[model samples]
Every structure is written in structure tokens, then in C-alpha cells.
Target: MAHCALEVADVFRSLGPGWHQSVNLSLGQLKVVSAIEQCRSAALGGHVLRCEGCAAIEVAYNSCRNRHCPKCQAAAARRWLEARQADLLPVEYYHVVFTLPAAISEIAYYNKAVIYGLLFDMAAETLRTIAADPKHLGAQIGATLVLHTWGSALTHHPHVHGIVPGGGLSPDRSRWVACRPGFFLPVRVLSRLFRRRFLEELEAVYHRGQLQFFGEHTELIDPGVFAKWLAPMRACEWVVYAKRPFAGPEAVLAYLSRYTHRVAISNQRLISLDERGVTFRWKDYRVDGRTRNKTMTLAANEFVRRFLLHVLPAGFHRIRHYGVLANPSRRENLSKIRALLHVALEAVDPDGDVSSCAAQPSFVCRHCGSPMIIIDMLQRSRPIRAPPPEQCHA
Candidate 1:
């Protein structure tokens, strides 16, 4: 793919220092700003490469490898997909989404770790509960859920995207029980259960004094007010819907490759940064067709603020697997399921040799198709100097 002329790093490099002076940002958010600014720049040193075929030399800079960095996710996604490739079954797969209501999302902005963890748990539980019912699929299903905290316009809209197989193993583990050819579980049922479980947990967390309220939400610190505030969400419909099943395993892998490691926005979507503001393209899902694609510009400060809204709590796992695919027993479970389905176990490379592939260089010559060998190491540069303590505090 062609490199984007504009990138999030460019926006951060231009406005981040000034924004930092004006805003009181968390340590995590501040690190994100600094990392993006220096990503793939000389600040993080990288090795020099020389092409075997063309004898061309190139200097490559190291990526920050921050999960939130758009430039860093491609390799991360590639590595993740390779690991998951063996987990794919021949069965059809479905895409489901469970979204927190706007009111809850507002609370989530302050309690991201607690609320986002609840979202993942409840979504996974809802799927398992509904799927195991004798009346529904009546089987144990596995699902991979990915958390996306941003809307197209960089708004705080928290949702979990679920990739689930259309079927599961029988209670006794004797047979593979598949859902109806086209349908997975009922969305209405899943949504109601998810809403109930999430609210119950939220209330519990509130009682434990784990939730914090600020600004207009300060009144919610009172139990009565918090209950009243949650009243509307109890009756409102939480968005949970499942799309049609993927065409096949290949299509499912393709979908995972795109959604699994995505950041809030890609560099490709950035249009330009100029006197007007930072302009970028975004999709309005509420609309249909070409009209949904539109550009919006925000003052650099506001843009940075919106972008940081999704930094997430430190050490949070945004991607999770549940049910049969649960990490503890995934390999054994996959082995059993493949046997039950009469499918062959995932094959190793023919001749059982991988050293050849491993020996290949990661980069190639731009002009000639030949492996580029690392000719020399580049030590990391000293970190950019920070302002003096008095000046920083000022």
C-alpha cells in the first residue's frame, strides 16, 4: 500500500506539545502522544538494510509498537492472524455487535477499565447463555470479541464486535451442533440478557464504590440519583445485532485481519492539516451509500482530545476469546472439534520445514524484488529532552 502523506503522528507532532500545556492529561494519554510523535522516527532507532539483488541501501526507523499507533497495528494484526489461522473451522461464521447505550457510555468514559471489562464479560456471557439453552442452538459456542471504543467521528461510542461460529459442540461433546443454515442466535434475546447482566454488574460496582462520577455526573454518586439515572437505560433497547454469516473461512479471516487490530483511525483517513484545522474523512453509519462518506475538521486541540478519549486503561486486554476458544484449553478443544467434525487437523508445512521461511528477510528492495539484509544496527537515540520541572508545572 502507498504511504499516506498525512498521518496521526503528523497531527501529534504538530499540536501535541501545545495541547499538553493546556490540558491535564493522564500519564497514559501523555505516553501515547509522545510515542506517536516519535514512532518510526530516528528517536526509536532501527537497522540499516541492503538489498541482495540491487545493492540498494535503506535506513529504516523503528516503530513505537504502541497498540494505539495506526502505523504499528499492521504487523501486530499479521502476527495475530497467523496464530489464529489454525483455529478456523470449516463452519460458517457470524458477526455480532453489542453496543452500550449512550448514557452508559458516558459513565464508561470515566470508568473505562471497569465498564469495558464488564462489557466484554457480559457480551461473552450473553452469547454463551443464549446459545446453551435447549431451545436455541443448544450447544457450547466459541466467540472472539473485539472492543471498539470510538465512533466514526471519534466520539466515545463503546461497542464489542463478536465473531462467532454458526454452531458448537453438543453438551456431551459427541457431535457438532450447527445453527440453522443462515441464522445464529436471536439478537433480541441476546440484547436483553446482555443489558440485564451489565446493569446488574454496574450497580454492584457502584455499591462497592468502584465507580467515579465527575462534572454533571457528580449527582450520580448518590444511590437514589444513580438508580434514577439508570432507569431509562433499563427500558431502552441496547443495540445488539448479528449480520449474515461470512461466505466462508477465508472471508472470516479477511474480516478479522481488518477489525482485530484497528486503531481509532488510520493514517489513510487523514486528509490534511492546515490553517483551518485537522481535516479527516469519516463515515456516518446512520446514513446509507456514498453520502455516509464525509470529511470533518476539528481544531487541532479538539481533535487531539477526541483521539485521546480512546487511550484505554493501562494493560487492558481489548481482544478476548470465550467459551470453547477460551485460552486455557483452546488447543485441545480445537483438536476435539476438528475430530468431531471429521475435518483434518491443521497441517504443518509440507516436509515439516519452516527454517527456510524463517530465514527470509522482513523487508525487500523497493526497486528490485529481493530480500534486504540487515547490514547494521542503529542504537536508540536519547529521548527528547523534557521541559524543566518549573516550566512544565507552569
Candidate 2:
């Protein structure tokens, strides 16, 4: 049998050094280096267990399971969506995207900690504000916003994808105003508002000197940089498209499961890792090749370089809430919305819920309120002993 090491440690043993080199090579790419290194070994230990059929013994160390760690996000995404089941409403939900102007994104990457954070807040607020406008829906809506930094080509494009219910409660919070059956919010109007709100927030952050620019981006620190950067986007058509709303709740959960804990890439996508450089699959988005896996072979150095480009600043949030979903109002607003939408009773059975949906994780230690989570797990195989009970005399 072609047996490979079962634990993440083995993968890191072969790959960690290259990642470290990839980081030191570029100041710009250093963001994800530590994240990858931390994910390489099993710092969190686990007891050994024996396999039933093969009775093979191997170490199955724990995983860092960081959302950014490709090794960990899949299970996380599923869990997040699972919990969402109880929160979902029985209405069509729309997928709305809010994109930052290219003029700003260049600087945004350097100041990702601030600018991207602002983008999420602004985007979510815009959605909430607009939906609450007596002109739009009048009902305060709920949204799940997720941040993504890369475009299909691996370029640093900051954007937020919002999954929102079709309609919201009337201003009085008594009547349920169903959204246009097919359309949620008008895409064009939402896009423009999103652009303006984002730019305004960007300016606020800039004026406060909260934004940082390093190396070639140092020029952007000047007000002139802000003005020059803001001009093009002021007129640019910000893309806030409404995809076909989900056919139902099942579809909604399925859609979000792929994105909630997404990392730059996953391990299964890697085809080969030998001296032939690193061959992996990437989507050719220009041609809608997202579903079809196209193999990309890059020099080991280049591969590491691309992989490290996505690391976010430590403690930055890639997922966020707005409007009724914001922390202060989440519980109360959810209760009201549930009553209004007549979905207070989750249709799915409790037992069935666990197997089907994944919840957004808090990473809490349970013992403490801090953002605590398992960083890694290390598992070792146990030796299988013969059944001696039958001949205890030995």
C-alpha cells in the first residue's frame, strides 16, 4: 500500500522550510508565513487509537485548524453553517457582493488590518441602512458577511459577500415585507451606495491617520494620495451583483459552507509535491473554470510565494455582522425577526440539524470568554494487543 504519513507533521517536515524561505524573501509576503509554520506540526497532543480493519498504528496529530490554514477550514465551514440552521428564516435569500475600488485596494493590502476591517463594517452597515430605508424594504434585515482577499487569479482584491434574506420586517417590526420574489435589492443602487459608503469610511480612517503605507505605498500617506485614489472609484461602477437567490434554505446553507472558513487553497487540490516543483490545481476564472481543476506547476519558491501572499494581520476578522446581526442586536433582533417571519420554530429536527449544518465558530475555550481555540492536535497510534482474556493464565 502507498502509505503516507497520517499526521500534519509529516507534511510540514517536507514543506515548512520552503515556506520559511518564501517569507524572508519578501516583506510583502510575510503575512501568512507564521500561519503556515504554526500549522505544520501537532503542538496539541492526542492519544493513540487503533484502526479496526488494518490495525495499523500511526500518529494522527491534531490540526491548528485555523481558518487561514487550508488544512483546517473545511470542517470549520461546515460547523459554522450547521449552527446557522436555527437562525435561518423561511424566505428567499440573496447573495450580495460589495467590492472596493482598485484604486483603494493597492493601499488596502498594505493596511489590511485597518482598511479591510473598515470594508466589512461599511459594507454590512450599507446593506442594513439601505434595507431599513422605508423606500427599500423598511424592515431591519439580517446578513452574514464574509471577507475575501483574493480574486480567482490570486490578486489581492478585497470584497464582502453578504447573504441576506429576501425581505425584512416593516418599520413597526410587526409586518413581514416579503422581498420581490426574484430580486432582493436592486444591484445597481446597492453597488453605488456601497461604493460611496466604503469611500467615506476609507476617508475617515485615512484622516485619522489609522491607515499605514510602507515601501512604495508610503506616498499614499499624503492627502494627495487619498484624493488621487478616491477620484476614479467615485465614478467607478462598484460591483454589487445579486446572484440567483437560493431555491431554499438547504441551498443557502450549502452555499455558505464553502466560503465561511475558506483558506487560499486546500490540500486535496495538491496533485504532486516532488522536485518537479509544486503542481497544484487553480481555477481559471476568466473562463469560468472554477469548477474544473486546472493543474498549475510552479517553482517551489514561487508556489510558496503565492501561498504566503494571503496571510491576514493577526486578530483581524474575516467574517463579521451588521444591522440586526450585529452583536448588540443579534439575539433580540433575531427573536423579533423569527417571530415576524414565522420561522421561530426551525423546521429541521434537532438531531438532523447536527448532521446537516455547520455553525460559525467563536473559538472560545468554553472555560474562558477569550478567543481560545485548539491550535493543533498530535495523535499517535497505539499498539494493538492480542486478546488475552480468554487465556488469563498466561
Candidate 3:
């Protein structure tokens, strides 16, 4: 299995000098670069694991456990789903995506931690409020929202993916009100309400001096400039795409694995990362049914720049809950939802087969030629580590 870091390294080495030395480098991005370099498998602990296909033995190291680290996304993904298991309702769920326009991407990059936060809150609130309307489901809806910051080409495209139950409890909390079998809320109405609530909140944030613009957007500090800039977005059709409601709990889990804890890109998509720049596969949305995993090469510096664009703010969480999933009432709400739907309550790892889940491949130590079991798992208690160039031996 080729790791994203290794592929990054192949690109990282080819960049001209002063790649990481530029003054424009944000403090947030510098941390990601440092974290990724220190994540070489040799440092964390594997020795050498031989491949069955050939006599090849690779050295492996443990991941840095950072959310942004591609290697660590899987572990975090599993843990997130485990916690969310307690929040799953018995009814079918829907996957709703809310996309911001390109005009907003620059502002979003400047205030990612704030505007994105507002985006999630306002969007979730809008869905719940509208669904509770008598004309709609007329009940409280529960949802799980996760933020995605990168597009297929690694550009800054901030969007929110919502995993929402199709229906919810009425005001009386006495009975279940299932939504239309194939639908949840009207996308047309959700778009309008979402647009209004989001813009209203954005204006409040701007007025309180919470927003800032830099780089090419420095002039946006003026009030009139921002108002005019925002005007075009209102008429620009705020994108809201709703997929078919999920079939059942099993399908929900499958969807969670794909959406939750997903990094900008995955290792499986990478084909080669040698001297010919960097090459990887991606599903192009414009091409329709035709699928291609073609590899494209890019200069190392440009590649790293693109990858680093997605490094989130420190301590910022991408996944959040609303309504029934909120921490204060999640457990009780889950029980009630289960009762109303007459479905048996289930656990995250219902079968207690977590360990039996697929195990990652480990490298055998070069000296001992034995499978190197992890002797110590590094935690927050461990001292901070500097960058490691070559493989750090176990």
C-alpha cells in the first residue's frame, strides 16, 4: 500500500529550494508540513513486513494521529462512527450537500473556522425549522454534519455534507412522522431558507468585526464592497443537492465510512509518484458515467501547496451534530427514536467485532525479519518530535 506521505515526499524532494521558506506560508500550514514529515512510518515503530507477492520487505511507522494526516484518517473515521452509533435514528437517513459559490471560497479561506461554523449551524437550523413546518414533515429532524474543504482537483471548495434522518418527532414527541419515502425536505425551499439564514448570520458576523480579508482580497474590508459582492450570490442559485434517502442502517454505515473523517484525498487513488511529477486517480464529475484513474504530474512545490490548502485550523472539528444528536439529549433521543420506529436499538460495533475489523498491513523489521508489533503507542503525553527525513528505525 503506497501512503500519501510517501507520494508527497516524491513530490516534495523535486521542488526548488525555498519551497517551505516563503514568507507567505501561514502558521497553520507550516504545522501540517512539519507533522507530515515527522509521520514517516520508520519513526513510529514497524520494523520490516515482507510481502507475500515477493521478497519485498517494507519499513512501516505509526501515524502522527493528527486529523489532517492521511494515514490517521481511518482510525479517526472508525472512532467517529463508533460515537455516532449512539445517535443513529431508526428511520431512513438522507445525505444533503450544501455548496458555497466560488465567490465565497476566498472569504471562507480567511474565516474558515468562523464562517464554516456559521454555515453548519444555519444550514442545520434551517433544515430542522422547515421540516417542522406543517406543510413538510412537521417534526424535529436530527442530523450529523461534516465539512469538506477540498474539491476533486484539490482546490478550496468548502461544502457541508449532512447525514440527516428522513423524519422526526412531532412537537408532542408522541409519535413518529416519517417523511416522503424518497424525499426529506424540498431542496428549493431549503436553498432559500439556507441562503437567508446564512447571509443574515454572515452580516452579523461582519458587523461585529469577525471577518477579515487578506492577500488579493484585502480590499473587501469596505462594507459596500462586501454587500455588492454578496448580492451576486443571492441570485446565483445557492447549490443544494440531495441524494436519495438511504435504504437502512447498513447503508448508513457504508455512507459514513465514505464521508466522515475523509481527508482531501486517499492513498488508493495514487498510482505513482516518481520523477514524472505526481500522478493519482480521481473521479471526474464532469465526465458522467465514464471513470478514469489517470495520473497527472505536478511540480513538488505546487503539489505541496495544493495539499496544504486543506490543513484545517488547529483544534477545529469537521464533524458536528444537531437536534437529537446533540450531546445533551443524544442518548435519550436515540432511545425515543428507536421506540417510535419500533426498531431494536443497535450499537456502533453491535457485534463487538471491532478488533476483527480489517487490520492494516505492518512491515517486518529489517534486522529481525519478524513482524514488528507496536511496543508503545505514542500519545499526547509523548514529547514533541522534529522532522525525520529518512525512515526512523524502530
Candidate 4:
């Protein structure tokens, strides 16, 4: 069966070299483009397999495993989810989204490392601070925050999706405190605090010269101009909304699998590619009608430009845990929370017991519906191609 009718790799393979020849790009963007073009191909090497039932031979190529490659995220997400399975608490889970305004998005394009890092800190602090207030949940909660830098249609709209347990440990750390059913924290309270704290920290960064301005934003280099530019955003409402609690742990896991490793666009969204260029489906959240799910086609060069806009700063983390779920104290915190809630740990499977989920199937026989085994390993070789142009698309 075909994995996908159209793949992101195909688009890169067809247009990437040409795009590279025409524009200037950062080292990170260039690397991501190259990685996507080579993913799941012979250049990365493969395994030769033989079907046990019919002696059919098949070769499976290795994936580049780049964070920005659409083809590589599924495996990465599955591996991440497997590790997180044990971290699940029996309590309800909430989904909260913290979005950056368009005013800051322009600045973020040039100062990604500083701005994005600040966004994460402010978002986590917002949730923790509001939840700890006596008028709100009044406890210390844990959250898993994943950063997404693009919206549908590959536009630069930075946001964080937070997965928070619906309750927390009392200040004394001796009791389980749960929020009322279907609610987590007040959105208005969260929005106000998030906006105030974000602006305060942003001003500090500007004064420290931690941010850079380019193109139309060069005026922002002056402290007076920058402060005035930030004035209007202080009063505009920031988007901070929480969804209803998930059905249970399994539901939360299912949701996490979709959000944690998503790229600018997925293969499944592609509709067609022709002389007119690339067409894909995107949802317009600004609309409130049936026409929201619309098809957009961009010239080949524009499409590549939009895709490369989201390549994050190298070594900057996109997934993070905060508060009680912070990595250093996660295990001990979970143990204490479980005790307070009177919930037992998940049952362990003994040797020879059926696994909770099947091990990754190494292979499958297309002819006889049987499993395929690796019979031989292939060595990787550098791909031979025309020399890429000195200039690449931006």
C-alpha cells in the first residue's frame, strides 16, 4: 500500500536544488532542506529483507530523522510517546494554548533563539502562577509544553501547546487538589498575566540588546522607538485558552502524538503539484463558515520560502516540562502524587506476557500477509548529484 499519495520529500527532490540556486538561506535552513531531500532514500542506506512466507525481497531505506522533515516525525513522536506513557497520572489533563501576537512575530523571525526561549518561560510561568493563586486552583501543577512556530499554510505564528494535569499537590505537598470538572484555570486571568509578564521580560531583553532588528524593524534598535512599539501590544488581549479535560490518560496520549512533533506541513495535506505550483489544504481559523478548509497554491519558490521560515535555532529545545513535571523531580513527584490520590502504579508485565503494545514490526510481507525478516544490511553511500548552486532560496 502507498504510505502517502504525495510526500514532502518529493517536493524537495523536485524543487529544492532549483530553490537553492536562486536565493540566500541560513545554515540551519540549508541543512533542513538537504535533510528532507535525502530522507527515506538510498543515500541514507537500507536493509534488505526476505518474506518468510513467499520469499519476496524488499528494501527499506533509513530516514534522515531530522526534526523538520515531515516523513521523520511519526517515528520520533512514537518513540517520545512511549517514554511518556509511564509519566501519565490518573488525574484529568488539560490542553492550553499560548499564542504570540503578530507584532512580536516579525521580531521573532530574526531573534528566534532569544524570543522563543522567552516565550516558553513566560508561558510556563503564567500557568504555574495563576494555578497557584488561592482564587484559582491554589496548587502547584505540572505541565508539558511543546513549541510550534508555524500555523497552517506555513505562516510564522509562534505558539505553545501545554498539556497540564488538571490538579496539583497542595502547598504542603500532602494532599491531592483537583480542579472542578471540565475546568482548569481562568482564561482571562491567564491572558492578563501572560501579557504583562511577557512584555516586562521583552523590555528587559531589548535593553540588554539581546534582540536584533533588521529590514523594516531597524528603527526598533532605538530604546525609545522600541518602547513605543510595544505600548499597544500591552493592552491588546493575548490569546490564552484551555480546552476541556481529556477523556483519560489514553486520550491524552493520543493528543500528544499529534501535536508534539508536528512540522510546518505534513505529506497528507498535499493535494497536487503542477505548473501552477504546490496546492495544499489549510484551515482559516479567522473564518467562521464552511469555507474555512480551503486549498492554497503558491509558486514553487514561495512554497519553499514559507517552509524554510520555520527552521528553529539549532540545539534550542521545542519540547519542555515544567513545575512538578520538570525532569529532575518527575519520578519522585509522580510517586508522591500517586500516594496522595490512592492510585496504584500501572501493572507490570512479566516475562513471556503479551506486551502492552506490539514491538515495532521490523518488516511486513506484502505478498502473503506475513512478517519479513532482515536478511542483509546495506552500507550507506554519499549520493552523487550536480553541484548545488552557490546561492540558495531564502
Candidate 5:
């Protein structure tokens, strides 16, 4: 793939130092900024590669490998998808999204670890709870939930994208239970349950002194005040909707490859960064058709601020598997399900195509398609500067 003329690294490298000095950022956010600025640059040591076919030589810089780095996720996504290919069931896959309202999103910014954890747990619970009901699917289902904290314009829109099979195993574990054709579960039922459980859990966390409030929300530190604030949200509808089932397992993989490891924005969406600030494309979901795609520009500092808003707390797993797909028993569950469905075991490469999931050499000869071998390591020419004391940890 051709590299984009502009990248997030370019934006960060140009504005990060000055912007960070003027703003307050968590240690995690600071690390993200620094990592993106130095990613694939001379600051990080790299290796020299020589092609076997044409004997072409090239120098490749190392990637920062930060989960939030746009340049790093493509490779990470490929590896993750390759692992997930084996778990694919020959059944319809449904896409479900659960979004926190704007009010809750503001609170999540301050309490990401707690609130985000609740979002995952509550979402998973909501699905399992609804699906297990006899009136509903009446089976145990598995889902892969991926959390995305940014909207098209880099706003703090915390949501989980769930990939679910159309059905699950029966209660007795004797047979496969499939969902209604082209439908997974009722969105309204899911939405109602999700809202009730999440808010209830959030209130409990607040009482336990696990949630923190700041700035305009400091008044929420009071128990009564917090309860009053959550009143509106309790009455409002939480967004939980499911899309049509995917055509096949291939389509499901294709969708996962795109959404599973995405950052706040991609390099391709960036148009230019100049004295006018950073201009980028965004989709206005409120609009229809081609008009939905529009470009907006933000002052450099503001752009960096918005981009950093999405840096997750350290050691948080943004990609999670729940219920039948839970990491502990996924392989065994899949084998049982395959048997119940009478799926024939076939010999197939988990990596699929060499040009796809399999890792490619860092460099290949342009003249002849041949592997590139690492010949030497390139050490950093200068000592790397340390981060500020406040931003040094995490």
C-alpha cells in the first residue's frame, strides 16, 4: 500500500511539544503523543534490509507499536484476525453497537477505567441476559466486543461494536439454536436493559467512591447531586442497534479487520496541515448520502487535544470476548458447536493468503518480488529525551 502524503505522526511531530506544554494531559495521553511523534522515525532504532532477488538495500525505521497509533494498527489487526479466523462459525454474524449518551461520555472522560469497564461488562451482560431468556433466542451466545471512544470528528463518543453469531447453544448443550432469519435480538429490549444496568452500576461505583469528578462536574461529587444528574439519562433511551447479518465468514473477517484496531482517525482522512491548522474529512451521520462526508479544520492545538482525548488507560483491553466466546473456553466451545452443526472439518490455512494476514518482510525488492533479510541494526544517533516528571510514568 502507498503511504499517505500526510500522517498523524506528521501532525504530532509538528505540534505536540508546544501543545503539550500548554495543556494538562494524563501520563497515558502524553505517552501516546510522544509515541506517535517518534513512531517509524530516526528516534527509534531500526534495521537495514537487503533484498535476496535484486540485492536492493533499504533502511526501515521501527514502529512505536502503540495501540492508538494509526500506522501500527494495520499489522496488529492482521495478527489478531489471523488468530480469530479459527473461531469463525459457519453462521450469520450480526453487528450490534451500544453507545453512551453525550452526558455519560463527559463523565467517562474523567473516569475511563471504571466507566469503560462497566460499559463492557454491562453490554456483555445485556446480550447474555436477553439471549438466555426463553422468549428470546433461549441460548448461550458469544460475542466479540470492540470499544471505540471517538466519533468521525474525533469527539469523545464511547461505544462498543459487538460481533455476534446469529444464534447460540441450547440450554442442555445438546443442539444448536439459531436466531430468527436476518435478526439477532430486539434492539429496543437490548437498549432498555443496557441503560438500566449501566446506570445502576455507575451509581453503585459512585457510592463506593470509585468515580471521580472534576471541573464543571465537581458538583456531582455529592450523592444527591449525582443521582439528580443521572435522572435524565435514566429516562432517555440508550442507543443499541443491530445491523443486518454479514453475508459470510469472509465478510465478517473483512469487517473485523477494519473496526477491531482502528484509532481515532486514519491518515487517509487527513487532508492537509498548514498555517490554517489541521483539515480532515469526517462523516456527519445526521446527514444523508454523499453530503454526509465533509471536511472540517481545527486549530492545531485543538486538534491535538481532541486526538489525545481517546488515549485509553494503561493495560486496558479494548478488544474483549464474552459469554461462549470468553477466552477461557472459546476453543472447546467452538469445537462443540461445530460438531452440533455438523460442520465438516477441513484443512485450511488459518492465515488464509500469504499476501494478506501473514507477516511480510519489512522491505521487498521493487524490481523482483523477493524476501528482504535484515543485515544490520541502526542505533539511535542521539540520546532520546525523557518525558516530563509528571508524565513519566505509565
Candidate 6:
């Protein structure tokens, strides 16, 4: 989690309003910008804390807690991982990615809600379908599919990362079906099935008038034109690849801690902001080893626009669980799976003690190492004036 000296919020604070006006931003994108600008600032209000031992005081502002805010996702990710800790099984986990082709992605830019949902549904279906085939694992598997819509350079590259247990339950529910060592399902099979299912579903949605096309894609409104557009995608290879299995369940948690809450870009990638542009590092997958992580500079407004390209539709879920891990049957399925694996059930705190779940460190006195205690409620009306220059720790 290496962070650059400058934060995305700093960029927003300096140039957000003008950037917002330069583009016709969606409601969700506007909300994200507003949150980033106001996050942890005097605008949102905060509290004053006093060191229990040193008598030194500090001000801490409130977080916007918007999911898309880079400044706010770290804690959100940690809390989410804590809750998911109990869900881990004593089994191997596999990482699989299903990515849409560039053609489909272009259309997705205009039809995010429909296409993104299709991605989740088809990705989950592909895994479940293939795993259930007798020629494959022949088991009913579950997956945690997280939708990511941006590439390294913040381009619209829609993909779903699936965290699936290396094995699953027997068709009869009588045994734990395990995959071959170091392998889950074949990527080739997954690609074909995913592409076919996705295109079929996309066509269904189009026929129902559920997908909208604008700009260059406006001609796709015609059924014949749309069919011609999709014909090539049907033959082209879809991108589906599986990474090596995670070391173990703990490794899975570590991976989830990073990916689960990530926004389009983290503040860590931002190197510097200047009159010329904002420079940030991005991995160039097209390049060979040693030069992949390259810096990219975009005009401030352009950077903001590319970042906003990923703002999701309102109430859209980017993270989802399917099959056994799905909400309705998760508890029961996990209980049965744990029993089959002979793992003990995690002890549940019936009274739900809130403190036990809080994993973050208590803010401490930098000089004396004693915990800080809230001393005063700071109202928004109180402008966040500078802390006494001699006393402030920043």
C-alpha cells in the first residue's frame, strides 16, 4: 500500500469544480467528485482529540464513506475483510478473470447498467456451468465475483474477477469434490462459454430495448446492424484467464483486502500534479518485463474525465456472490461444507460486541504514545482553521 506524496483528493481540491463543469458528468460521477472534495475536510465537519498523556490536541475530519472515494476505501476494505474472515473455508482458492472484448466494452461505455449486470451473471454462470459438467470438475461451485470496469490507465475495460474455491460439493451433496492439484477449470472452455452466453444475453437485452446506443454506436440500434457488430466478437477469443491458486485461505484474505475495495485508481499511483498535467504510474500490459509499470501524464481535466468514466450507475453492485456463496444459501452451504471438511464452526458472539470487531489502531499521541481521546465536538460552522502552527503534527 505505498502511497505517493500527493493524494487524489489534493487534485480534486485544487481543480474539481472546474473539471466538473467542463464535462457533462453523470449524477453518480458528480457525487463521487463532491465526496472526494469534501472528504476529511472542514466542509464535512470533524472532531478534536486530546492526547491522554501529552495534553497535545489534534483535529480529525469525517470521511465521506462513498465507495468510490479513494481516500475512504482503505478502512472500508479492512472492515469488509474482517466480516468476511469468518467465511473463509479450509480449502484452496482460485482466481479467475473474465474480460469483455474491446468491441463490447465500447458499447458498455454507453450501456453500463445492462452490460455490467450481464458480465456478473454470465461470468458466474460460466464458472458454475463448466464446473458442473461431468467432463470438468462435476461439482457445484460458488464464487465471489467482483466487477472492475477500468484498465491500468483508467480505460473502460469491464471484467469480473472470480474467487472460487478450488473445489465444490458433489452433485449428490454427499462428498467434497476437489479440483486437480494446481488447476481449476480450463480457461479455453470458460472463454468460449462466457463469450457465447454473454452475447446471447446481450442480444436478448437489445431485442427488449433495454440497451441504449449513442454517438458512434447509434447505428447499432438496428437489429441487422447490431448483429453485424456482434458477429466478429462471436468468433474472436474472449479473455478469460486463471491465476495460480492462492497459497491458502489467508492469502485469499490478503488478496481480497486489496482488490475488494479498490476504486478506479488509488492515491498511491499519483506521482505529481503540475501545470503541464498530472503524472501517475500505470502498468502497460502490452509491454514486456522491466518496463511495464510506466508513468502516464494526462491533462488535469482529462485525468478527471478518465477517472469518471468508471463511475457506476446508482445502486449498482460491483461486488457479488453467486451459487453457494450467495446470500440466501450461504449460511447453510458453509455449514454443510465445514461439516464435510471437518472444520469447526467459528464461535459467534451472540451479544455482538462492537469493540471486538474494531481492528484499527487507536489514534495515539505521536510524542508520548498514549491513546488520544475525543475532547470536543467540532461543528461544520467552525471553519477548519489551521491548528496552532507550533503545535500541529502534520
- After superposing candidate 3 on the true structure, give the runs of residues whose Cα lies further than 4 Å from its correct spot: 1-6, 13-18, 45-60, 274-276, 287-295, 347-394
Better candidate number, 1 or 3, judged by TM-score:
1
lDDT of 6 by residue, 1-394 (tens): 2334888777776684455554566656666777777778788888898988989988888888888889888888877777777778888899999999998999898889999999999999999999999999999999999999999999889999889998999999888999999999999999999999999999999999999888899999999999999899888998899999999888999999889989999888998999988899999888654548799999887888898888888899989999889988887898889999999966655332234666545577777888888888767643322223333221
Q: How does each model score on lDDT?
A: 0.88, 0.67, 0.73, 0.87, 0.88, 0.85
Candidate 3: TM-score?
0.83
Tens-place lDDT per residue, model 1, 1-394, is 2578999988877774566766767767777877888888888899899999999999998988889999999989977777787788989999999999999899899899999999999999999999999999999999999999999989999999999999998999999999999999998999999999999999999999999998999999999999999999899999999999999999998999999999999998899999888999998877644448899999877888899999988899999999999998787888899998889955545332322345556997888979899999898885533333443432
lDDT of 5 by residue, 115-186 (tens): 999999999999999999999999999999999999999999999999999999999989999999998999
Per-residue lDDT for 1-394 in model 3, tens only?
3434444544554664345664356666665655655565454443444545445545455567777767677777876666555566667789999987887777888798888888789878988899889998899878889999998767788999999988888889998888988888889999998888888888899999999898788877999988888887777689888999888877898889888888887655556666656677665665766765555666556667778788888788788889877767877887787888788854335433344343544444455554445433433323234224222221
Please write out the lDDT profile of model 4 over residues 1-394, one tens digit for every residue: 3588877767777774455766778767877877888777788898999988899999998888889989889889987887788789988899999999998988999999999999999999999998899899889999999999998989999999999999999999999889999889999999999999999999999888799899999999988898899999988999999998999999999999999999999999998888898899998888764448889998877888899899999899999999999988988898899999888877534321225655656578878978899988887787523334455443
By lDDT, the better pick of 4 and 6 is 4
Better of 1 and 2 by TM-score: 1
Error of 4 at 279 (Å): 0.5
Best by TM-score: 1
Clashing pairs in 6: none
Q: Score every model by TM-score.
A: 0.94, 0.78, 0.83, 0.93, 0.94, 0.91
Worst 10 residues of 2 by lDDT: 385-394
For residue 117, give model 6's deviation from the true position in Å: 0.3
In TM-score terms, candidate 5 sits at 0.94
Candidate 4 or 3, higher TM-score = 4
